[model samples]
Target: MTTILKPLALAATMTLAFAAPALAQDAQPQAPSQAPAEDKTPVTPEAWAVHLQVTDILQHYPAFHSAFQGPNSFRPQATTGNTVDATLYAGVKPWAGGEIWGNLEMYQGYAPNNTLGAAGYVNGDGAKVGRSHPYARIARLFIRQTFDLGGEADDQEADLNALGRRRTKDRVVLTAGKLNATDVFDTNKYAHDPRQDFLNWSLITAGSFDYAADAWGYTYGAAAEWYRGDWAWRAGVFDLSIVPNNAVLTSDFSQFQVIGEAERRFTLGGRPGAVRLAGFVTRGGMGRYDDATALALATGKPADAALVRHYRSRPGAYLNVEQEVADGVGLFGRLGWADGTYEAYEYTDIDRTAQAGVSVSGERWGRKGDTVAAAVVVNDLSSAGERYLNAGGLGILIGDGRLPHPGAERILETYYSLGFAKGMTFSLDNQLIQNPAYNRDRGPVDVVSLRLHLER
Candidate 1:
C-alpha cells in the first residue's frame, strides 16, 4: 500500500478545515424543558469532533540479517526481526467540553524479550512469534471518563480567573485495563525489538498499550486521574494476580496491586518550549503461593513451602525539556531515575539507575515544512546494586557489582518526513552496544537500521 498525497496545497486546505469558527467554543446557557428532560442527557453535536482519526501501523526491520534469532545457530547471531500491528485509535471532543478516547491494537510476528532469554545465556528462544493472547501478547481494553469536580461549568464565569492560574480544562480519566509499564527512563531506546524499534532493549516500551495482553497477565483494575492547571495525577488499585495458564502461576495468597503517578507540565520560554517533571510508583507483590525469593532467603522450612513474598515495587522521577531553536531546529532533553522491582516467574530485587539524554528535531534546509529528527539516549547503571537479567533464561549480572562490566549501550536515530505527504517517512537508526551483559568478552555490536513508515 503506497499512498501519496497532492503535496502542500492539500495539507493547507486540511489545516484550514480545522481552523473554522465552530472550532472555538462559546458559553451558552441551558434552555428550560426542551420537549422533556430524560434520565440520560443527549450530547450536543460539534464539527471539531470529526477531526479525529483511527490510527494503525505495521513494519519490519532486518535487524540481524546473518543467523537464526536463536543462540543455537552455530553460524552467528541474527538481529533481523519484524512486527505486525494495528489499532483502532481515536481522541476527540464528542461533547463540547468532554473528550472520548479508545484504542484496540494487535501485536504479531517476531520480536526479542530479555526475560525469554535469546541473547546468550538462555540462547534465544525469544517467542513463538505468531498470534498469541493477552497474558502472552494478544490484546487489552480499558476506558475513562472525566469532568469538573468543582462544579464550575465555564471559565468565563470562573471566579478564580483573576488568579492567573485558573484551570480552564478539568478532567478525571478512569482506566480499567492493562498497558505495558516498561522502564522509568527512555522507551525509544529500550523498547521491544520489532517494527520501528527493532533490536532494542525492554525497559523502553513497558507502558505500551496492547489489545489483549494475555488471559491472566493483563492488569484487571481501574485508575483515576485528575488534570488541573498544568498538573496531572493518577492512582489506582488493581487485581495483581497475573493471568496464569495453569495453577502454578496463580496467586497462593495476596490478590491485588496498586499504582500511583503524577506529572507537572509547564512552558520554559515565551516561545515554543516546554518542560515536564513527573514521578510514578507501583506496588504489591505477585499473588503466587510459592514465592521464590522469599523461599530462597528463608532458613529452616523447605524453600518451596516458605513461599516468597515480593515486597518490591517500582518508583521513578523524571524531567523532560523541549525547546525550539528555530522553525526547523529544536532541542530536546530528558533525565530520570528508577528503582524497585516486580515478580516475573520468581521474586527478585530491583536496583536503581539514573539516565539522561538529549536530541534535536525540526525542519532544516531553510525550509519551513521539511522535518528531520536526530536523537541519542544513554543509560547509567553503574550505581545500581547487584541485580539479575533474565539475560535470556540464563541470568547475567553486569554493573552494580553482580556480573561483568558490559559497558553501557548507546543508540542514535535519525528521521526525515515531508509534511505535505501523509503516511510517508524514512528513518535510520544505529545502536552501539558495548560489552553486552551476556557477551562481556565479545566487545561491541553495532546495529544499523533503515525504516519506511506511513500513517493516516
Candidate 2:
C-alpha cells in the first residue's frame, strides 16, 4: 500500500501544480470598470478551437496463488504500474460543411506485466508499448465533412474535436485519416473513454472485435455514416499493422480491414436507447492455431504461431446496446465473437466475450458531478485456441507456457469518480479477476487503481 500511495501522492502534487494557475485566475477580483456589458446579438459559430487534457493512472495488484508460471504469465507477486498522458486537440473549419482536426500527445508508463497475461487486461490506458520517459506522437489528424439531408437542426457544443455550431439531425458524414478505430465504431457512451469511464479493455471495447490498430491503438482509415429518421449505417476500411500487433503499420494498404455497422435509436418508456450491430473482416498474413501447433510438434519444440504464417482472412461480429433507465442512470452491454481458428491479429486474445454494466450519476446524492459504475465481463477461448495453448502456444496477451486447466476468464470492476473542480476529476477503481489467462490453476487476483484527469 505504501508503494502505491507514494506515486499517487506525487501525481496529485503534479496535478495541483498544473491547476494552480487556473484556480488563481478564477479567484482574482475584477475591477468594476473592467466588467464588459453583456451582448444581445446572436453568437457566431466558432471558426477554430483548441482543447487540452491530462490523465494519470496508478494501479496495483497483490500476489495470488499460482501453481506454475510461464514466460507470458502474469507474475504471481505484488506489483504496481503507472501511466500518464497529455494531449492537445485542435480543430478548424476549413470550409463550409468541412472540418480538420489534429491531436498531439505525449505518454509514458506501463501496465502490469507490461500488458501481458490476461485477455481482459485491467487498464484501458495501458498500451502494448511503454517507456520510462515520455514520448510524443501525432495521435490523430483527420478531416470530417457533413451533408445535410433535410431534418430538424440541432446545436452542437464545442468539444474536443467539434466546433460550436448547428447541424441537421439527418445527414451524411464522411471522415478520413489517422485516428483510433473506436472513434468511429463500436462506441458506447457509458463504457467508452478510459479517461472518464471504465478502464478495462474488454469493457471499453468488444473483446472479440479485433479492430485494426498498431501498438498505440491508432491507424489510418476512412469511414462514412448515413443517419436518417431513427437509424444509422456506417462503413469503414483501415490499414493493418505490418505484422500482428506490431508498432509499424502497412503504408501500402496491402493488408487491411473492412467494417460495417447498423444502429437503431428509439425511445423506450420515455427513455432513450440505442442498439448497434457491427462486423469486421481482415485480410492479412496470419497463422492458424492448429497449424502452428502441428508445426511445433513436428519440430519437437514449443508452439510458435509466427512459424506458420500465411495470407488469410479473419472475420468477427458484435452487438452493443445502451439505454438510459433514469435521469442519471444508464445500462450498457456487449456480446462478441471472432474466428478463433486463426491467431488474433490486433486486439487481445479473446475469441468469445459477454459484458454488462451500469453507470449512475451522483445527482440523486446531491453531488451532480460525481459518478459510480460497475461492470462484469466473461472472456473465453475457442476449442482450437485452447488446444493451441495446451500445446504451449503464446498469444497476444495470454499464455501460461502450458495450459493444463483452462477456464473462462471472469472480471468484475467498479469505480467511483468525484468531480471536485470544473473540468477536473479523481477516480478510484477496483477489479477482481478470476481465472486470469484462462488458467484455473493460476489465480483470482485483485487490483486497485487511482486516476486523476483534467480537461480544458
Candidate 3:
C-alpha cells in the first residue's frame, strides 16, 4: 500500500502543479448548464485543432478467502496496479470534405497480473500489452473523405475523431488507415470512453463481439459510412494479428475480419436516441475448444490451443442502444453473442454477454460538470469453452486452470466523477465481480479505483 500511495501522490502533485494556473483562471465560476452549446459556424478549411488528455487510474482489491487458486486465477492476496496514458489528438481540414488526423499516445503501466483471470477485466484503458516504462505509439493516423448529397446540413462537434464543421445529413464518408474498429461500430455514448465513463471492458463494449485488433486494441483497417436521413450504414475490413492474441499485426491480410453495422436515429419523448446492430466475421487460422481439449486428453498434457489450429471462420454479433431519458440522464444497453466453438481472437473470453446501465449528469444535484454512472454485465461461455478452461487452456484474457463448477461471470460497476478544476476531474470507482473467469468455486472479488483526468 505504501508503494501504491507513493506513485499516486507523485502523480497528483505533478498534475496539480501543472493545473494550478489554469484553475486560477477559472476561479470566476460561471453558470452551469447541461452543456455549452457549440458554435454553429464551421471552421476554416485550413484550420487545425490540437487537444491533449491525460488519465491516471489506480486500482486495488482487498484480500479475500479462496477455496482454490490456479496459475491464471485471481490471487486471494490484495493487489494493486495503476495505468497512466496521455494522448494528443491533432487534426486539420486539408480540403473541402476532407480531414487528416493523427493521434499519438504515451502509455505507462500494466493491468493486474498482465490482465489475466477475469472475463471483464477491471480497466478498459489497460492495454493488452503491458509495459513497465512509458512508451509512445501512434494510436490513429487516418484520412477522412466525405461526399455530400442534397439534404439539410448538421453541425459536427469538434471531438477526438471529428472536425468542427457542417455536413449534409445525407453523405458518404470513407476512412482509411490505422484505427480501432469500435470507433465506428457498436458505439454507445453512455457507456464508452473509459477516460470519462465506464471502466469495465464488458461495459465499454459487448464482451463477446470479438472485433479484430492487435494487442493495444488498434488495427489497420478501412471503413465506409453512408448516411441518409435518420439512418446510417457502415462496413469495414481489417487485418488480424499474425497470431491470435499476439502483439504483431498481419500485414499481408492473410488473416482478416469483416465488420458491418446499421444505425438508426430517432427522438423518443423529444429526447434523442440511437440503436445499432453490428456484426463481424473473421477468417483466419484459428483453433477450436473441443479439439484443444481432446488433444490434451489423448496426449496426457496441458491443452494447447495452437496445436489444433486451422484456417476457419468465426462470427459474432451484438445490438447497442442509448437513449436520453431526461435532460441529464441517459440509458444504454447491449446484447452480444459469438461462435462459442472457436477460440476467441481478441477481446475477452466470453461467448455470450448482456449489459444495461444508466448515466446521469450532476446538474440535477447542482454539480453541473460532474457525472455518475452504474452498469451490470453478465458474461458466459459455452460448455465446450468451459471444458477447455477446465483442461487448462488459455483464451484472450481468462483461464483459471480449472472449472469444476462453472457459472456466468457477473459484474456490477459504478463511478462518480467530480470536476474539481477546469479541465480536471477526479473519480472514484468500484466493481463487484462474481464467478470470476467463470469459475464458481472461486471468489466474488471487490475492486476499487481512483482516477484523475486532465484535458486541454
Question: Any idea what lDDT model 1 has?
Answer: 0.35
Clashing pairs in 2: none
Deviation (Å) of 25 in candidate 3 = 35
Scored against the true structure, residue 312 in model 1 reaches a CA lDDT of 47
lDDT of 2 by residue, 12-84 (tens): 4543443344345445775668768875443358899999999999999999999998888889999899999
Which stretches of model 2 miss by more than 4 angstroms?
1-44
- Write the number of the candidate with greater lDDT, choosing between 1 and 3: 3
Clashes of 3: 0
- lDDT tens digits by residue: candidate 3, 106-209: 99997676777798989999897778999999999999998988598665777777788777889999999999988888888899888888899998899998
Q: What lDDT score belongs to each candidate, Candidate 1 first?
A: 0.35, 0.88, 0.85
Model 3 ranges with Cα > 4 A deviation: 1-46
Off by over 4 Å in 1: 1-78, 90-102, 112-140, 148-167, 178-218, 237-257, 272-279, 284-316, 340-362, 366-371, 380-402, 417-420
Candidate ranking (lDDT, best to worst): 2, 3, 1
- How much is the lDDT of residue 7 in candidate 2? 42
Query: Tens-digit lDDT track for model 1 on 134-175?
Result: 222323344434455563332422110011112235666555
Quote the lDDT for 49 in model 3. Answer: 87
